[model samples]
Target: MTAQHAAAGQLQLNYWAEARLQRWGHIAVPLSSTRVAIHGGYGRDGKKLRRLDDVVIVSSDGTVAPTVSSTPRPKARERHGAAAVEGGFVIHGGRAGGAFGDAWRWHDDVWRELRCEGSPPAPRWSHAFVALPGDACLVCGGRGDAGDLDDDAYVLDPATQTWSRVAAPAFPVAFACSTSDGQTIAFGGGRAARFADAAWSELALDDATAAASRRLAACVCATARPGELVVAGGVPADEGEVGGVAVLRIGEDVKCVAEAPLDVMRAYPVHAAAAFSGDGVVVFGGGVPCLSFAPVFGDSVRVVMT
Candidate 1:
C-alpha cells in the first residue's frame, strides 16, 4: 500500500483497507462532488459465489464506509449501468438471475423501482452507459441472454420517466469503457464476436481519431479535463491479460499521450470511474492478473494522477 503523493511522471496510487469484498461489474456513481456511492457486483462471501447488494460510500476526504438503505431493496445485480440524475442516481439494465430490463432510482437514501414508459432495451450486461445533457442517459451495446451481442442503443429521460431506442453502433461490443464530454461520447475496445479487438466508436459523430486504434477492454474511463479523457486498467488485444493507462486528448486531432503503467496488473477494475477535483481518476475494485474463470480478486483502490 502506497500513500498519496506526486511522482515525477508516474501517477500516484494510494492503497487503503478493503471497504467491501473484491468484485467486478459494480457501478460507482457520484453522490456529491466529493462522495460516490458504489453499488452491486459479483463476488464471493466465503466459499460461495454471490451477487452482492451492498452499497459503500467513498469520500474524497479519505473516508470509506457502507450505507444502510431503507427496506424494499432492488435485486442484487452486476454489469449494470448507473448515472447521476436530477435528484439521485438511476440504475438500469444488468444481469441478476438473468438479463434484467428493470430500472431503479435511488434518492433521499432510498431505492424505488421505476415504471418507465416506451419500449426499453432488451436484457443485457456489460453495456456502456453515459449521462447525457438534459437529465438523460444513453445505454449502448452489450451481450444479451441468448449469448448474442447487441448493436442497439437506448435513451432514458428522467423528466418524463420514459425510455426510447436510439441509433445503433457500427460495431456491437461488450465490456467497453466510455466517457462523455457533453458534446460527444467516445468508447474504446471491447469483445466483439469472439476475441477482443482494438476498435473505437463514437456517439453523435463519425469523426475517428488516432487514439481510437488502441485496444482496451473492461477498462474505466473518466474526463480529466474539459476536452481530455483518461482511460485506465484493462486488457489489451495484443497483450495476454494485463493492461495499463493512457490519456486521450481530444481536439482537432484526438491522440493518446502520457501513457503509464499501473502499480498492479488489473482488468475490469471499476465499472464506472469517478473524477478527482484537480487531475486524477479513481479506480475501484476489479479482477487482477487475468480474467480467468475462477478469477483472482483485487481489493486496492488506484488513482491515476494526470
Candidate 2:
C-alpha cells in the first residue's frame, strides 16, 4: 500500500498488495476524526474474518495512526455480523442459534444483552443500521426467515433499551442498502415481495410523514455525502443483474449519471452489508436470492462518485 500526504485538506490512504487485503470489506466511518474503521471478511479460502476494532485515526494533517489493544472479541457469538458504537455504547447485530435476533451493547470491554419493551425486528442477517444524532438508531431491511427478504423497519433507543416501529413509506421498501446523510438516512432497493424492485426513499428525521422518493433501482449498496446518496449496483428483476449506478440528491430527483460494470456479475441477497469510507462506499460479502452463484465472502469495493 502507498501512503502519501499532500498539501490539500484531503488525506490519501490506499491499501496495496503488502497489506494483504484480498477483498474490500464493510467500513465504519467514525466521528471522532478522519479515521475510517474497517472490518475484513474471509472468503472460500477458509481464513477467519478480522475486525479492526482499534480505532485507526487519520487526521487532516495526512497522518495515519492506530490505537491497538489486546482486547478480545465482544461477548457476541454470531458468525457474520455488523456493529456500530454511539453514545458511548457499542451496538451489535448478528445471528444466534440459527436465528438472527441477537443484539448486544458493549461497555468497558464487556457486552450486555439489551432488552426492550417492543417486538424486535424479525431474525435477519446482513442488515443495515445507522444511528441518528439523537438517541435513536434506525435499522432498515434485511434477509429474513426461510431465505426470504424483509422490508420491515425498527428503531432502538439507548436510554430505555426499547424498540419502536417506523412506518414504511407509501411504496414498499426492501433490500435497503443505506447510509446516514448526517441529518437523516437514505435507503434504496425494493419491496419485500420476492423478485420485486422499486424506487429509493430518503427517510428524513425532521418530518416522519414527509419521506422523499426516487426511481427504480435495486440498490444493494449506497453511500451518503453531504448532499447526495451514491447508490451502487445490484440485480434488477428483468436485467437479472445490473451494471448500473445511480445518485439521489438529498431532496431532489434520482438520476442515473455514471455506469460501471462489476468485475463479476452477482445478485446480492438482502444480507449484504455496506459502508462509506475514504472517498467511496465499501460493500461486504453476501449471498444471492436463488443461490445462483456460490456464497460470497471477502467481497468489497470503493465506489467513487463524480
Tens-digit per-residue lDDT, 1-306, candidate 2: 232222111222122121222322223344333334433222222354433233333332335454442344433222233435562343445444344565655443344667677867776644555555454666655455566344466777766888877754343443333335443444433211111122234433222112112222233333545444544444454445543334444444333334444444332322334455556554333333236754443233445554
Off by over 4 Å in 2: 1-33, 39-92, 106-112, 146-151, 170-172, 177-224, 242-245, 265-272, 284-300
Among residues 3 or more apart in sequence or in different chains, the pairs in candidate 2 whose N, CA or C atoms overlap within 3 Å are 126-271, 174-190
lDDT of each: 0.62, 0.41
Q: In model 2, what lDDT does residue 91 have?
A: 45
TM-score for candidate 2: 0.59
Best by lDDT: 1
Q: List where candidate 1 sits over 4 angstroms from the true fold.
A: 1-10, 44-49, 173-181, 188-217, 265-279, 288-295, 304-306
Model 1: per-residue lDDT, tens digit, 13-101?
55544636367778877666677777888776568767888778777765778778877877898888888876578888889768987
lDDT of 2 at 87: 22
Best by the TM-score measure: 1
lDDT of 2: 0.41
Against the true structure, candidate 1 reaches a TM-score of 0.80
Can you give the TM-score per candidate against the true fold? 0.80, 0.59
